[model samples]
Every structure is written in C-alpha cells, then in structure tokens.
Target chain A: MDSVTALGLVAAVLTTGSFLPQAIKTWKTKSTKDVSIVMYLLLCTGIILWTAYGFLIGSIPVIAANVVSFIFTFAILALKIKYK
Target chain B: MDSVTALGLVAAVLTTGSFLPQAIKTWKTKSTKDVSIVMYLLLCTGIILWTAYGFLIGSIPVIAANVVSFIFTFAILALKIKYK
Candidate 1:
C-alpha cells in the first residue's frame, strides 16, 4: 500500500483499538455509571453510517476500522444497558 | 454534495457529536473512576493520526470530523487526568 493508505491503516488500527480498553474496563468493573449510554448509542449509529459510507466509497480502511469499532462499541453499549 | 459524501458528513457529525455527552457527563460528575484513561489516551493519539490521514487524503468530512473529535477526546482526556 502507499504511504497515505498506510497512514490511514495505522490511524484505523489506533482508533479501533482504542475502544478495547473501554470495553474491557466496563466488562471487568461491571460499572456503566460513568459511561454515557447516549454516546454509545450515537456512536453505534455513526459507525453503521460510516460503514455504509466506506462501502460506498470503496475505502477498505474506513470499512475495516468502523466494523471493528462497531464490535467494540456495541459491546460497551450492551454492557451499559445490562449494567445500567 | 453527492449522496455518498452527504452520508459521510452525517456519519462524521454523529460520531463527533457522540463525545459531547460523555464529556459533559465526565465534567458534571467529576468521576473518572469508570473511565479508562488508556482509552482516551489512545483515542486522542488515534484521532490526531486520523486528522493527519484526512489531510493526506483530502477528505473534508474526515478532516472536519477528526478535528472536532480531537477536541472532544482531548477534553475527555484532560478531565480524566484532572479527576484521576
């Protein structure tokens, strides 16, 4: 891949991976008090749209990043609901 | 704008706007206990890189979204540090 794509890939990895710790924390602590339900709700909606946008644009990095982000954010959202 | 770009703009708005509630919650509650610093740290770093990627790719939506996201994520990060 070109450098720009590489940069995007790296950015994608960092952004998507960032959610892991949040998910893990919520899971381990079983505390969703500080986590905003609205944020995740909006986030999941946004991620779905982003995925759609990615497919429409044929951008692999965007699609891949949002897909993984959806998994992580969705888990956090589920935990928020379950624990809330 | 084209439909795909319009979709991206909407996605950008949603994702960027999602952080407001979290930042507000953290600010009002002054509780970072449930919030993961690592996540925000990673998110901030990732967002910065995403901004760079946006500039490189010349995507207005990506650039605008990531810029606003960086502000919110950075604010959250600051709050996390302050409260922790």
Candidate 2:
C-alpha cells in the first residue's frame, strides 16, 4: 500500500488493538464497574456509525478497523450489561 | 460540506464525542482504575498519528476529530498516571 494508506492502517491498528487488552481483562475479571457504561454505549453506537460511514466512503482502512472495533465494542457492551 | 464530508464529520463527532463523558467522569471521580492504562497509551499515540495523517491528507473532519480525541486521551492518560 501507499504511505497514506500505510499510515491510516497503522493508526487503525494501534487504536483498535488498544481495546483488546481491556476487553480480555473485562472478560476474565467480569468487572465492568471501572469501565463506564455510558462510554461503552456511546462507543458502540459510534463504531457502528463509523463502520457504515466507512462502507459508504469505500475506505478499506476505516471499514477494517471499525469492523474489528465494532466486535470489540460489542463484546465490551455485552459484558457491561451482563455484569451490571 | 458535501455528503461524504458530512458523513465523515458525523462519524467523527460520534466517535470522538463518545469519550467526553468518560473524560469528564474521570476528571470528577479521579478514578482510572477501570480505565486501561495500556489502552489510553496506545490510543493517545494513535490519535497523534491520526492527526498527522489527517493533516497530511488534508482531511478537515479527520483532523478535527483526532484533535479533540487527542486532548481527551491525554487527559485520561494524565489521570491514569496521577491516580496510579
């Protein structure tokens, strides 16, 4: 890919991957107390919108990142509800 | 703005604004226990890169969103350090 795409991909990876550890921790610890319910709710909604926007724009980087992020956010959201 | 730009702006607003409540809560509660240190660190770095990428690409929506996000992440990161 070109440099711009590479930059976007790298940015996407770092931002998206940042959530992985938290999701795993939440899963293992069954703790969503510290994780803000409002934040997750908003984030999940935002991720869905971002994914749709990415699709509309035909941006692979945005689509790929948001897809993974959507899953992670959904996972966190589910845990938030379950643990609440 | 055009439709594509409007879509991107909306997407950016949602995703970036999602963090505002968390940042405000953290500022008020002074709690970073549930907030993942690793996530914020990586996210802050990613936001910086995204801002730079946005600048390079001349994307006003991306730049605007990432700038706001960067500020919130920085606040969270600072709290994470102080409260750790």
Candidate 3:
C-alpha cells in the first residue's frame, strides 16, 4: 500500500486504541460516571462528518472504517444513555 | 473550503455520530459486555494509521479528526477493559 493510505489506517488504529481502555473499564465496572458525555457527542459529530466526506469522494477506506466506528460508538452511547 | 475538504469533514462527522449512541449508552450503564474488544483493537489500528497518513501528507483535516477520534475511542476501550 502507498504510504498515505498506510498512514491513514494507522491514525485510525491509534485513535481507536486509546479508547479501548475506557470501554473495557466501563464493561467491568458497569459505571461510566467519569466519562465525558460532551466528548462523545463532539467526537461522534466529527466522525460522522468524515464518513460522509468519504462517501462523497467514493473512498472505500473511509467508508469501511466509519461504518465500523459508528457501530462501536453507537453501542457505547446506548449503554451510557440507558444506564445514566 | 474546497469540496474535497468539506466532504472529508462531513464523512468524519457521520462515522463519529454513528458511534455516539453506543458511547453514551456505555457511559450511563458502565457496562460494555456486549461490545467487542476485538473490534476496538482493530479500529484503533486503522485510526492511528490514518492519522499518520494525514501527518505525512500535511493534511490538517485528517490529523485533527484522527487525534480526536483516538482519544474518544481510547476512553471507551479503557472502560471496557477495566470494567470487564
């Protein structure tokens, strides 16, 4: 793969990795009072916009990553709202 | 902004938003048993790669989004791992 593509993919990995700890912690604790609702809300907004940009450009990589990301985020969001 | 830039921004927004529900849900419930640790791990890999690509290319949009995304995803992942 080209360097640009590879880098883009790497960025995705890092961002997602950073959040895993929180996800795991929440699962075991059944409590996310410390987590920030605004952060999620803002982050989701940014992600969605990027996903749409990918579609507009007909970019497969963007589409694929965003699709999975949306699902992952959605699951956590639901739990947060429901449990809160 | 140019169309490509605008479009890219939009894509970011959509993908992120899709996951907000899940994030929010997990935050409130403090339970992410249903969420997949594997998925987060893989996603983090992709996001980090993408973010790197943007840096290499000097693309502000990619860098900004991935940076935020990584933090967001990392938070959830941490919670999941810790609590589960």
Candidate 4:
C-alpha cells in the first residue's frame, strides 16, 4: 500500500481501536453515568454518516474503520441507555 | 465542492461537533470518573496522527476536522487528569 493509505489505515485503527477499552469498561462496570448521552447519540449518528462517506469515497480503510467504530459506539450507546 | 468532498466535510463536522457537548458536560459537572483515561489518551494520540495524515494527504476537511477534534480530546484528557 502507498504511504498515505497506510497512514490512513494506521490512523483508522488507532482512533477506532481506542473505543474498545471504553466499551469494555462500561460493559464490565455497567457505569455510563459519566458518559454523556447526548455525546454518544451524536457520535453514533455521525459514525453512521462517516461510514456512508467512507463508502462513497471507496476507501476500504475508512469504511472498515468506521464500521468497527459504529459497532463500538453503538454498544456504548446501548449500554448507556440500559444502565440509565 | 464536489459531492464526495461535501459529504466528507459534513461527516467531519458531525463527528467533531459531537464532542463539544461531552466536553461541556464534563467541564460543568467536573466529573470524568467514568471517562477512561486509556481511551482518551489513545484518542488524542490518534487525532494528532490524523491531523498529520490529513496534512500529508492534502485534505483540508480532514485537517480542519482533526484539529478541532484534537482540541476537544485534549480538553477531556486534561479534565480527566485534573479530576482524577
């Protein structure tokens, strides 16, 4: 892969993978009180749109990163609602 | 701008703007107990890399988005540190 694409992939992995720990923490603790609902709601919506944008641009890295990101954000969103 | 670029800008705005409320909430509440330090640290690092990647790729939207994103993430990181 070209350097720019590789950089994008690395950026994607770092940004997207960062959420995993938060999701897991929230899951294990069942405490999303400090996690703002408004923020997650907006984030979840934005991530869906990001995935669409990624698809439009035909960037597999963006698409793949956002899809995984959407899952994690959705999980946090769901957990927030459940534990609320 | 072309449709793809416009879409990208919209996606960037949505995602980046989503963080504002969280930052505000944290600032007002002064409670970041549930905010995972690992997640924010990784996110902040990723955002810095994203800004660099955007510069490398010559995407103004990406660069602008990531700069704002980095500020917000850094704010959260600072708050988490102070309140921890």
Best by DockQ: 1
The alpha-carbon root-mean-square deviation between model 1 and the true structure, to one decimal in Å, is 0.9
Off by over 4 Å in 2: none
Score each candidate by Cα lDDT: 0.93, 0.84, 0.64, 0.88
Task: Candidate 1: list runs displaced more than 4 Å.
Answer: none
Native contacts recovered by model 2 = 0.60
What does fnat come to for each candidate? 0.87, 0.60, 0.46, 0.71
Backbone clashes for every candidate come to: 0, 0, 118, 0
- Tens-place lDDT per residue, model 2, B1-36, is 788767667777878988888888888888767677
Model 1, A7-74: lDDT tens per residue?
Answer: 88888898899999999999999998999999999999999999999899998877988999999999
- The DockQ-based CAPRI class assigned to model 2 is medium
lDDT of 3 by residue, A1-84 (tens): 986666666665555454565566566666755455555565566667767777888988767766666665655665667666
Per-residue lDDT for B1-84 in model 1, tens only? 789988988998999999999999999999989898999988999889989988988887779889999999999999999999
Listed for every candidate in order, the interface RMSD values in angstroms are: 0.8, 1.3, 6.9, 1.1
CAPRI band for model 1: high
Candidates in order: C-alpha RMSD to true structure? 0.9, 1.3, 6.3, 1.1
lDDT of model 4 at residue B16?
95
lDDT of 4 by residue, A1-84 (tens): 888877777788889998898899999999888898898888888888888888988887788888999999899999999998
